[model samples]
Target: MKILLVAASAALLGLASVGAASAYDGTNCRAPGNCWEPKPGYPDQVAGSKYDPQHDPMELNKQSESISGMEARNAQRVAHFKKTGEFVYDVKKIPAE
Candidate 1:
């Protein structure tokens, strides 16, 4: 009988927890980003800081240029390897992070 009572109490506590969880109206943001319900008409720049990279044309241009440069370098490496049966390696003395 004591075991049954304890189990019933635990079940009631679990249901109460569920009820408490469902009470959230979704405006509040939790640490791990549970920001589902954002306020309507939210501005693109918050406090003069653009968070989304998609909106920044300069950033996109920089990324595209970087990718193109990498591809050109890789193509050069491939061409050199094909012409001479030796792989080219740029031995840069970059410090380990």
Candidate 2:
């Protein structure tokens, strides 16, 4: 009975550790943009400024541009469809034009 109780306790501890490790990596963000690692080349501040090795502005800008352009195009298409009474859109044509 004691051995069984000890085994159950060990299993519970292992489960808790696993859950902690998964809190960040399981998120949607991956690659340089979302993960941070310290680099030695950068300047160290007197106050010890925070360093994020995952800083990739290019990827973030790409995501932002893609999302914004799609949203704007969708809005324009909706407006055009309302005005022209056409529910269908051409894949080859630009939105609202």
Candidate 3:
């Protein structure tokens, strides 16, 4: 009887997993543009840590913006290196010789 019950449960779980396709991408909508943003202070009440990056839009945006700034700086550095064969962290700060 236990073996039969276990087998049935396993089969049900397998079928359930197969049916689940899309996952919640923080906005509750799989598509873009029309995503519903959660009300401020609402997500904080959810049963999770305040620092969970997966659900924290502010954190994710902050990180993405920081990365973009870093990439821009890196691109500038690479361009300067290619043009001058030297790496200068801040070209403006270096006094013109």
Candidate 4:
């Protein structure tokens, strides 16, 4: 009876360990090919800078430009499909200069 109890306890412990390990596996950000590494000195720069604005306007401008560019490309694709009655799959023709 004692031997059976010991074997059961060991099995439970093994399962518990496996569950714990799997829980941590999903937490790794590098699981995907794209992972961001923080640039050196970035934290110190942000800490030292005065708060002129709640957020950086340049960053906002870049985001706005990216959104607008994507919208324009999508519009062009829709227009081409409407005119030619075919989907645009060519990468060269879809990208905006």
State which candidate has the highest TM-score.
1
Q: Against the hidden reference, what TM-scores do the models get? A: 0.51, 0.38, 0.37, 0.38
lDDT of 2 by residue, 1-97 (tens): 9999999999999999999997767345556577654355756553454553565789779989999988877776777778777654543464524
**CA RMSD, predictions in order:** 8.6, 11.0, 11.5, 11.1
Candidate 2's C-alpha runs over 4 A off are 1-52, 91-97
User: What is residue 59's positional error in candidate 1, in angstroms?
Assistant: 3.5
Root mean square deviation (Cα) for candidate 2:
11.0
Quote the positional error of residue 61 for candidate 3 in Å.
0.9
Which regions of candidate 1 are displaced past 4 Å?
A: 1-4, 22-35, 40-56, 91-97
What are the lDDT figures for the candidates, one per model? 0.71, 0.71, 0.74, 0.73
**Clashing pairs for predicted structure model 1, backbone only:** none
Candidate 4 lDDT over residue span 2-57, tens digit each: 99999999999999999998674433376576546555444544544653256688
The sequence of per-residue lDDT tens digits that candidate 1 reaches over residues 5-92 is 9999999999999999978755776654666654677665666545444567787699889999899878777766677677766513
- Model 3 score (lDDT): 0.74
On TM-score, who's better, 1 or 4?
Answer: 1
